[model samples]
Target: MKIVATEGCHLIGKNGERWIDGMASWWSACHGYNHPHVREAVTAQLQRMPHVMFGGITHDPAERLASRLAEVAPDDLNHVFFSDSGSVAVEVAMKMAIGHWRRHDRPGRTRFLAFENAYHGDTTGAMSLCDPQRSMHARYSGAITQQFHVPLPRDETTETNLDRVLAEHSDSIAGVFVEPLVQGAGGMRFHDVNTLTRIRDACRRHDLLLIADEIATGFQRTGKMFAVDHTADLPSPVVPDILCLGKALTAGTMSMAVTIARSHVFDSFYSDDPGAALMHGPTFMANPL
Candidate 1:
């Protein structure tokens, strides 16, 4: 039979039986389906202002959400790059990392490092940072940039492995991408916070940018506002150079995602020459309805 409606955490199928939605609609519907509050908000939004392209314009929902995010984000991650979905958010983060290095005059540091069994998203650039042996896009290996893969550490001691990986490829590494404490798409593998802290330390020591893919762990899903909040073992709180977020940006009401970076990272795109500006953007980049 087919499910027709949802309330609270239960779904009502055609048979009239109520069942809990264990997967939460691919893990994005934190508030579940047919939630009264969500329904009202969406309906109200549709009446007032339904759709708007963000290519060069802004709307109330987008602006309010961006402001809320900046207020809640970690220090200096005040900038927000909006996209339609998580996959696109990942692509934005990757591009920002590359641009950050290029703008800083480190053009040769173009390679990226990600953990084995870590899944960022399905986009081409996101897929490249994923370990092909464990990623679904193994067949499309030739299309990706072939990032270095570090095995997820089982304990704090595994910091040595991260050090070794950085030592071997520090020169070419542009950034180190991670899924934080829990590697969601990789069968929900859980690692220690110290492991993330170590990775962060290694990235800083080697001058590599740290990109936290918190798409799955944002919005208190993991009992924290962001997964990086769990990393208290580091000498200081580790703030990623770039952060990719989605799924809960608008309480899952709208299809929205954001790529937040430090101001310096954004500065790279500022130039007198039009060609020097970051040329990558979707047609809906700043569209407003």
Candidate 2:
């Protein structure tokens, strides 16, 4: 039951009744629909280039967008691995995390740890990390891998519980994926940034990569440029080894997402063997227009 829109935050249906959009079309219209600026940009791009497969080629729009994202993203997240949506971006982050350890001679550390009630995307890897209690896919248990889920603790026992979970399963954990401050789609559950810092420290201590799924918390949604900025005031700020971004990548104009990782993670794919080349990519891998 998708509604048709004729203007920003306004919709016209089959019955021709116009109404203000409160639902915002499943919450994807960040600037609403039919925004003037967005329309103008799309119009201009359409005039210049309508479409081109982003495989083994480059284009100005993608390059410029990547440059802008790099400038605004965290200090260390300079690289951008683009995808068409948030789900694929989450998959990319997971693949990078696993590949990192495999390249470093630690293939046994393949398990991932995610907070309970966390929601990254709908893909298999993303669904695996999400709490089944909140997901509709709970009935299809065998469809995805099981990930360690740490309960979101209250102020009194947050640190203690987190430490206990990490200690219990730290040996086989490859990475920890978190939603930073606010866990959107999980009832908008919010946690203190300090809790993220503590988890970050625990991951570091356990030699596990920290992956931040900031698809919903990025780009000033949390009153900061990124939720990670909120943790900067902590004794040890949490800087994830990999950052997943989407939703507002183009301010919601285009369906684009990215996974930014440290140089070492990218290095894993730099090998002579084609099998080790991260044999996964979309047809539009490097579209140019």
Candidate 3:
């Protein structure tokens, strides 16, 4: 089953047999494979500039992409930080949440509360946010920071339990992390708008941040630009303070991901203090390609 080539929505095997790309390269190839337009864009950019360090230097592609992402993102998530993968993007989001609290004088708010069947990413921070009992990172339990894991609030009782958990751990909880409507890696679990609304209300009640890991549900995978968009009809509407996007971001062409934050979260770091900035940096972050 070795894929030698990819064209349109099919994969060419070693025996020249064509197979449908059912998962679209792990949900990254949104426009199929080898699309002429995508190829043209990649080629043009490749010829112009393939890679550049995104430290003090910036490029048009990065700025344009960031602006476009800000325009399409839900709510006022305008600040974007680029990363090389979804896991790292989730890591960055966790940092943003923790840093936001630390800058505001709540350094103790370092842990996250996530679903019992959630899958954020494989990185250290993101892995800690995944399902503690069922995720692949269970073997590394002692190696990672212990966080609160609760069941999805599908019913009033469960929702109340979530509230109780938040009430008990709100002080140390940096925020609530969720994969929104569908928990892709945590068994493709699906929850409705009511569930999302409950989570949002809980966060609001506890005055905690909400981090939505949309890496698998972003880019219309769940019939909306993001899974969080499904809750847009609620009376107050669910708006995550931080959003993590990846996988389909580069359309399977290259590695790219972004962590977007609302103004309040971004404002936490908006200071003249040199130590106030996010110190993490990925060398391949914002690669021109």
Candidate 4:
């Protein structure tokens, strides 16, 4: 069925029949489709200008939106790096984690550890985190960079192996990637909150970064603004060192995503030497529209 139009959670078919949206339009239209507020915002933005380069200039909507995002996101996730898609955002997050360690004289900490049946995104770095056993990227196994993978969390065994792997790879591991309470693309798998606590504890004890790919489960999808919010009950209750958010951001009206980091991570790249800066940046990073 061809959809000619959409409004809220319904789509208008070619024959003019209305169909309820079952997939949230790939889980992007969290506010439904063609929402009035978003439509109005776009219309107002159109009157001013559709878009402007972000390399050296600033704009109103982008500033306001970034501030609003920082307000609602997990504590200290204040630094935002915009991108064109979730996959790219994940790639950037990985770079941020590795860069953070490298700037501190641990360049060998370039590896990551994810779980079985996990799915972060489709880009090369993101695909490295995806489950290869029955995934679409199985054929690319020998093509992309390889990372460490372990079984999904279940009991004490999961924590044990996770800690053991971190201990064994203590000098080489960069970060531990997780999708939090719900692993959306990995068959909608859900794990206990204690599992998240365990992962957080492990990352802390090992002095490694914890990156939560919230592209598929952010913005109240998992009954909280972000999946990392569920980690509030942990002993420390701190947010992930870094987070990647997309899909629901901007209510899905635009192709936008962001990689957010805490102050410490941002400070790592803070330097007088130009070469110490983050070398990666998207052209459309902070477009006004």
Candidate 5:
């Protein structure tokens, strides 16, 4: 059925049928549909300026948002890269982690590590990080860049398996990327908190970056500001080196996504050489509205 409109938690179909939004518009419509606050804010933005090029320009809204996210996100994730969609956000994150090592003199560190039941996003780079066991992109297997996949961390040996993969990849892997806490498109798989801590420990021990795909688990979805919040109390102190967020940014009122990186990761791209800079930028990035 085609949705003609929405109010609160209900969607009105073209035929005038009212249906409760069970999926919350794929978990993006956290404030439900056509919310007054959302409408007002968007209307206010539309009045000011719908968009402007992110290249060679900056905007107030984007600045405020980046600041707010930096304040709320865990660890040293203070750098923000705005993108147009969730998939693209994951792509940016992949580049950020890969670039972090690449620019830091380990250019061969290109592959990423993901688990068997993980799901990051739909774009090719993002899809490459998605678990291939039952991926929707299985048909594209031959063409997609294959990433190292570890079995879902069900036991203490999960760390052992990760160490094995890292050892095998041996400096070729950019980092271990996972949809922390609840793996969303990967069947909503939820794991024990210890599992995440173990993963964090393994990354730290192996000196690899940790990329947390918080696109679906962010914005208080998992009862905390982000799923990573659940890992704060872990025995080993750690946080994601890079975090990807979307779906609920602007309360899902607009198509917006962000890749947040720690100062360490961001600093790697800071160099006197022009070639050392991160060159990825979407036209709609950091749009004013």
Candidate 6:
């Protein structure tokens, strides 16, 4: 369908047929369309600056946004890396997980343990992290790096299987990748907080990094700042070592995503040696406008 215009939460087509934007522009337009506040900010930003390279040159909006993200992010996830899309954010999280181990001299711990019926993104690296059997990217299996995909921890049997998989592949598994309470795309599946705790416990027991892909559930979509915040109710609250956020980050005003890491994860790359630094840098990483 051709969306000629959008107002509030509805889309207007060529024939002026209006339809509620139920999906929120693929779950990114959380604030609806043509919001005056958003428009004003964009207009003001445009008058001053639209886009600028984030390499060596720094800008106020990017710095302020980075600080705001750190302030609102769960736990000590204070470090942020920006990208232009959700898929790229997920890919960055994957790279961070694998690189964390490699920097610590455990290069063999390379692959990730992601859940079945989970969809991270469509990029080659992110595609492999999705459900290998059920994802639309299944046809590209041979082209992407294969990771471990297992069932969500919804029951004792599945939980046991998860434990077993982690135990058996502990040496090779760098981390656990999950969508937290709700899984999107592969299926709009929802698992309770206990299931999340089980995954967190398993990751803790095996000493593996936990990467939460909140691309679909961030910005209070799931009644929480981020889906991982539900874990705060557990006896021992848990947080992911790395968190991926996107979709509503700009409230659909523009395409933007972020991969945030905790202090320890960020510290691994903080060394005088140039090789120890995180090597990847996107061109439009922290576009001011």
Scored against the true structure, residue 41 in model 2 reaches a CA lDDT of 81
**TM-score order of candidates, top first:** 3, 6, 5, 4, 1, 2
Q: At residue 88, what lDDT does model 3 achieve?
A: 97
For residues 1-289, write the lDDT of model 2, one tens digit per residue. Answer: 3555567777888677788877555455678777888888888878888778776677998888778877877666777888877888889988888888888888877788888788878878888888866665576566788888877654548767777777787667889899988888887888887678777777877778889988887877788888998877766677788998878656556667788886677788888887787655676543332
- Judged by whole-model lDDT over C-alpha atoms, candidate 2 comes out at 0.78
Which model, 4 or 6, shows the larger TM-score?
6
Q: Which stretches of candidate 3 lie over 4 Å from their true place?
A: none
Cα lDDT, all candidates: 0.79, 0.78, 0.91, 0.86, 0.84, 0.90
- Which prediction has more favorable lDDT, 3 or 5? 3
What's the distance in Å from true for residue 72, model 4?
A: 1.6
Off by over 4 Å in 2: 153-156, 270-276, 285-289
Q: Residue 103 deviation, candidate 6, in Å?
A: 1.6
Q: Compared with the true structure, what per-residue lDDT tens digits does model 6 show for residues 1-289?
A: 9989999999999999999989998999999998999999999999999988887788899889999999999889999999989999988987888889998888999899998888999888889898988988888877788899899988899999999999999999999999988888977999988888889889999999999999999999999898888778777776889999999999898889999999999988899998888877887787766
Q: Per-residue CA lDDT of candidate 1, range 30-136, in tens?
A: 87776788788778867887766555566776677678888888888888887777888888887787777887888878778888888888888888877788777
> Judged by TM-score relative to the true structure, which candidate is superior, 1 or 2?
1
Residue ranges of candidate 5 with Cα displaced over 4 Å: none
Error of 5 at 240 (Å): 0.5
The pairs that clash in candidate 5 are none
What is candidate 3's lDDT per residue for 1-289, written digit by digit as tens? Answer: 7899999999999999999998998899999999999999999999999999999999999999999999999889999999999999988988899999998899999899999988888878888988878988888887898899989999999999999999998889999998889888788889898899899889999999998989988999989898888778867888899999999998988889999999999999888997999988999999999
The lDDT, on a scale of 0 to 1, for candidate 6 is 0.90
All predictions: root-mean-square deviation over Cα? 2.3, 2.4, 1.0, 1.4, 1.3, 1.0
Cα error, residue 276 of model 3, in Å, equals 0.6
By lDDT, the best candidate is: 3
In candidate 5 the C-alpha lDDT for residue 176 amounts to 88
Clashes of 4: 0
Which model is ahead, 2 or 5, in terms of lDDT? 5
